[model samples]
Target: MYGGADGAVAVLSVAEEQKHLLAYAPLVKRIVRQLNSQVAGAIDRDDMEQIGLMGLLEALRRYGEPDAAFGSFASLRVRGAILDELRRQDWRPRAVRQESHRLRDSVRALTRKLGREPAEKEIIAALGITAEAYQEYQLAENAEQIGSFDELLQEGMGQADSAPSPEEQLMVRRSLEQALRGLDEREQRVVQMYYEFELSYKEIAAVLDLTDARVCQLNKGALGKMKATLQSA
Candidate 1:
């Protein structure tokens, strides 16, 4: 419901609706296949594809049938639907969410005061947290930051759907571009390889000569910095 020409779609006969759904069925499968490859052991591919198909049906109902422009518009809705379900099934407890907020706020405050990103030791001191606790915070931060990166990638693809005007969309694009430009070269390459090139984490690691976990860390750090910059804009 974040956006769509929802309710503005022209009503169609039952036969027409079925035909359109059948036509877009492949798109749902394609999306599920890509997401399933990334999260192989975590979610059932069949279930994800079912959800994606349902999402496509809803998009048809609310945003109308297939058109040249409908694919990108429906793509956003389908992704949102899947991500919403994923969030509902998230394993994080309430306390973890709270701690992430605390860590994020502390880092933001420290950055403002220090006029630079805070070091791990400085952050530990600022938050009066143990090294182990700081590491936990980092894990929490990575989860949230990487989730945000998905939405950011969608925006970059011109698939943003918050009902912005053309001028507003332009500003958002500029802000995101500026934030991306601020990334270090390695971080930039990591992001591009993962998103634009649609490479798996393992594949990106092999190309970058780093471990899979290191690639995730680099991406997390890069997204964190871009998030801060984007918020300021």
Candidate 2:
């Protein structure tokens, strides 16, 4: 679909950039593939790849010295670009969000009516929705919860424009530390594996012998606790 002269220039630019990047196109592809799977069939893999390549170019420009850390630095920027695009896509349409709200409202009403939490059967009967549909609703909410938490984590990991003063930096790290302590042992491990080690949820699930869904749930719970702590701070 690329036209004549502009297309040639783009191709040449990418070729030149890749040379300076030390041929890190594989890293971009890996990140895009991993993220595409989690997007639930929303974004086209090719489009994400293009965004990732642009990110790598930006990384190389910003990173004047291609030292030992260039690979790590470029990887973060590439992944960040793809993640930002995913958020912008907001694959969950307005209809899906409205439906999620309705589902939560129904569950709340059922719990209040029962004087306690309602069982799955009770919920299905009251809402007249299939179990699979209910699961879809839960999945939507869980995805959003973890996505927000990732945005917070990404910013904390040096994505800011202006560097904070020493005191401010210490305070921010302390806030994160306090927020992390609110998690359980396993949840702490999950956070470390994610933010420290930069492992995917699927990878974490394999290491912990838990399903991806279980890992997401743990992160979602941690997000709730951390957000409350941050708000109160």
Candidate that would win on TM-score? 2
Q: Give the TM-score of candidate 2.
A: 0.65
After aligning candidate 2 to the native by TM-score, how far in Å is the CA of 78 from where it should be?
Answer: 3.1
> For each candidate, how many residue pairs have backbone atoms clashing (under 3 Å)?
0, 0
**Model 2 C-alpha lDDT per residue in residues 3-71, reported as the tens digit of each score:** 243322123355566687557888887777666656676778898899988888877665543555556
User: Candidate 2 has which clashing residue pairs, if any?
Assistant: none
Worst 10 residues of 2 by lDDT: 1-10
List candidate 1 stretches off by more than 4 Å: 1-30, 37-40, 60-62, 65-72, 91-146, 151-165
TM-score of every candidate relative to the true structure: 0.60, 0.65
Model 1 lDDT tens row, 144-188: 544466576465544354333345557766887798899999999
Q: Model 1 misses residue 231 by how many Å? A: 1.6
